[model samples]
Target: MLFDKKGLDNQTLLNLYSNMLKPRLIEEKMLILLRQGKVSKWFSGIGQEAISVGVTMALKNDEYILPMHRNLGVFTTRDIPLNRLFGQWQGKASGFTKGRDRSFHFGTQDYHIVGMISHLGPQLGVADGIALANILNNKNEVTAVFTGEGGTSEGDFHEALNVASVWQLPVIFCIENNGYGLSTPTSEQYHCKDLADRGKGYGMEAFVLDGNDIIEVYTKVKKLAESIRKRPRPILIEFKTFRMRGHEEASGTKYVPEKLMAEWELKDPLISFKNYLLKEKVLTPEKDQALTIKIKEEIDVALEQANAEQPIIPDRSVELSDVYKTFEYQHIESNSKAEEIRFIDAISQGLKQSMQQHKNLVIMGQDIAEYGGVFKITEGFVKEFGKERVRNTPICESAIVEAAMGLSIAGIKSVVEMQFADFVSSGFNPIVNYLAKSHYRWNQNADVVVRMPCGGGVAAGPFHSQTNEAWFTKTPGLKVVYPAFPYDAKGLLATAINDPNPVLYFEHKALYRSIRQEVPIDYFTIPFGKASLIKEGKDVTIITYGSGVHWALETLANNEDIKADLIDLRTLQPLDTESIYNSVKKTGRAIIVQEDSLFGGIASDISALIMEDCFEFLDAPVKRVASMETPIPFINQLEQQYLAKGRFEEELKNLIAY
Candidate 1:
């Protein structure tokens, strides 16, 4: 009977059967609803129920599991209320994501389940972070992350596996080889015979199992999870399964062979397990019928309740409320004890102070452990805080950033350093989609500060120097901070670290050593959404941030008659519009200077804002002085010509003359 449920007790066997049965029944009901046009979409895990059920039942409740779109059995097996599950599917306000996201895309911390994004690969790195948190906390918990065979081809898959292996993190990489990624066959995806073979390259123990066999899946996962808890290392298990249904309700399975579908239908996990249970006398006909009726009634009630609850209405306040967790504005009194330091050293001091304050703070990047990073900003951090907090990650920006998301999920604050701001393009998906959207989607606070060494003037070429702050500033739920001087750098960094939302802290590489000031040695935070009035005058208002502040200062210093009120916008997202409006109104003209290209830069947005709100007060047209629309040149002369430095003085004179 089911290959001898030898060590399993009668109750445990019955529980497994019920768990598997419930999802199967639920999927059937969902498919009916989809056809009836009640639900928007459905991703059916019909033939592959055993893997989700077995693996979930095997793990402890406290242990985290990052489930993909099709793992409906995971929610059901965890005994998450059917009402909430149905509500989520129905897109009701009662759902976990409050109708912000649909399907299994929402995660509930109460269930210790981190939900999957549409991009499946990032969650693997997120699971690594969760496992790393467990390790740091000395908890015996092992995290289990699931993905399809199609997802194995992703770079995130390789990066996550290697990182988990190197750290020996307790993670179960459950790969469901479902024979197809969307409509593409497995043959076209990868040439490897089995996905598990790829795990061997990462030096991880690999196993292949019949995913339809409930008993086998359950027994193996239970043993593996137990072993991982004791040894605390990663193991890859490839479950050979088939998707009996289409990828989603709309995408029909026309690409799959009819013969293969028929074969898998016969080997259905629920049918085989039911027959085995009946044969062992663990589940009689009467008991099975009663259980089916019970689950059906439960679903019926949940669906009704979900329907009765209000659907999401178009309310601006409600829509904007959950985008970011409110961080109380902190007022730090000026300290008497001050030490003169460079911008880089000020940032170092801020990080060290933050590390001492937050025990769970983690810093991760390449060469950050001992090399102190390329800029040496984190130099001696490993020695002071040890390697646990100061982590050196492989060149997997996507994975590390996703890991920071996971670490945030586990109540750990993290700071991810991008070697260069331009390199953020590699890790853009997780940062923009997952980390930035987590709070708005499911009320999850991503306490992460991504330290971006940005801007030009370093002669580091196109790939190294960039002012990409506008990318994040436009995205909802992300806080962007760009400081000018050493004092502002230290203070604003402290604020960013303390912020509950994901903050993109842009550190201009040019200002790192060139700028120096007396910064407070003690911990302090400058409030965000508040612009620092660098220099005040009545002729014109110069709105700028990062290196632009220095450019404006240099231009104003060279020309004493310009008499412009220079506003340093320390934070970009929660932009200090009030200050900009007030200064522009007072000056009757404005000029926005930026190191980035002229088109679609922050200056463009500021110019529009001035026109929209302060149009009547303008004596002349609002001007923008910015670099040329070209890749940052490696040659010093070409770079200088491309920068806004030469144009700022002329633009200021023209605006003042008008």
Candidate 2:
């Protein structure tokens, strides 16, 4: 009522009160519809409806919104069609999600609502991304992300806030602290009494408010939205509310004691505000009754319409709709074609070709723009491609990745450079939660590539030199490509661009200048989930990839009589299982090799798969040759002792003797 942005009239406040009431009715009506079997799932704002609605009211219509499961009030106020909303709940064809997606994957660009995934967290990354996109496009729009107090516990929440604050992104992180995270209270989640306090840890502004009060929410959100528009920066606003209903429609108040429920019911947000309005004479009984009745009627009509609608008949073709934004394929003539270009040179050419091929391609990260990246792996690029295409960024790893995720959604292929492999933890949120799962959430893949300079022998210390493949090798919906030579680097990077999943193309910082092999003359992309044959022999199988492939090749050459078949598993996630199986069965003996720690790395994953599928064919125990279980040290002497490759001379001799 105090704000003039919408010029508060008694009637206007009454209308907002009406809008707030409608969400409650909608939530109730939808629950009834769910029991009637019209919808599959339902999560109501209930006591917290005012916050969702009021926060949205403070925001610009053009600004993007990323919401959680209980954001019906936000969507309703944003003017998202009720039928489409019901369709999403019912998994109907009329929904933007094509009916096959999850119950919470709601999106409508028409309403400026991005995707509202029901999972407890992950929207923070989305909010950061949308805001970054607006910044890049010169569009001054704030992207608001809605979450609960419990979501603050997720690593994504911390990482997103850290990066958004660093970049000064126009993102408003709104946390609805409704006292309980599925019966585990806030006290169980964190020591700080308020969730907003965590925002200060990331060096961002924080606000705490009484969520039940709509007027307060409107005032706070309006001021924050204005401040972010003028000078962009991330801020966390914690709304202290209570979850009046059960976690879901199924659970009764079995977990919540009767006395507490009754005690909280007396302070019911709806009844409390209605009384306040009546006392102030702003809401006459006649007006209040009419407004309540009017909202109930509208919801009744929507429910009736929703019930009358036919169930969605899914077209199988719609299943693959928007699986990938773009795809390309090419073939090279022969092995000689690959023998013509140097490894780093091939990568440079592939990056350039991919950039020239697609107008939406953009490369970023530390030193990638002007210096052509830290290792000069991206050399000659800034000059040939221009600064916009190849960009330099601050040492903020999280910012580089967060920016990439935003661009990927905006139809830009964001190619990021991680100066070192071990330092990627700074950007892990965008990797695991955002890029990897973005497709699964919205039915769309992020076509971004994170070029990580990995592995050791350069004696660059623990922070700068190391192979951390296990960090993401097993994460779903992500392509992990480790290229050993120039041809594979060029071909795989090109293929990774065409793949639907996000890719972490691990480039050896040591091999950036050392490894020299001729790349093909023409543009060509290799197929993923396929292994490359480095050498053909049948006595033993050395299954490896990236830097370890060279070691395996050398070991085979040193002992020619071993007749080992060296297979390079170029792609880790969609792993070339058939190739490994065939080699293991043919040789009747196998050894897994990797540059990373033996524990929990690729060797373990490969060994498990072989045991599951090829145990019957094995003649002996499958061996694993990996670096010792120690950190890649700073000193070369200590590092060398720990850096045992798959094809080390002593390991090869020991295996042969066995």
Best by TM-score: 1
Worst 10 residues of 1 by lDDT: 1-10
User: What is the per-residue lDDT of model 1 for residues 297-397, given as tens digits with 9 covering 90 to 100?
Assistant: 99999888987988778889988988998898777756669989999999999999999988999999999989999999899999899999999999999
Model 1 stretches astray by more than 4 angstroms = none
**Which stretches in model 2 have alpha-carbon errors above 4 Å?**
1-6, 9-15, 29-44, 60-62, 81-111, 114-122, 147-166, 175-342, 367-373, 378-403, 460-465, 520-524, 581-589, 604-622, 630-638, 644-658
Pull out the clashing pairs in model 2: 339-518, 340-518, 341-517, 341-518, 341-519, 439-444
State each candidate's clash count.
0, 6
**What's the distance in Å from true for residue 329, model 2?**
3.9
Candidate 2, residues 1-658, lDDT tens digits: the string is 1223245667657756776887787888877777887666666668888788888898888887777777778888987767767666766666666655655565665777766544445567767767777776777778888888888887667767876887788898999988778778777888987788888788999999878777788878988899889888888899888788877777655777788777767666667777767776889899888877877777667656765778766565654434334444464344444456567787888888888777667787777766767667778888877776777766666656766766666556778888777888987866786677666555556778888888898887778878988888778667789999888898888877766568899988677787887666767888878898878887788888888888777776776777788899988866899999999899877888888978888898798889889999988778888888777898878888888663376765566567
Task: List the global CA lDDT of all models.
Answer: 0.92, 0.76
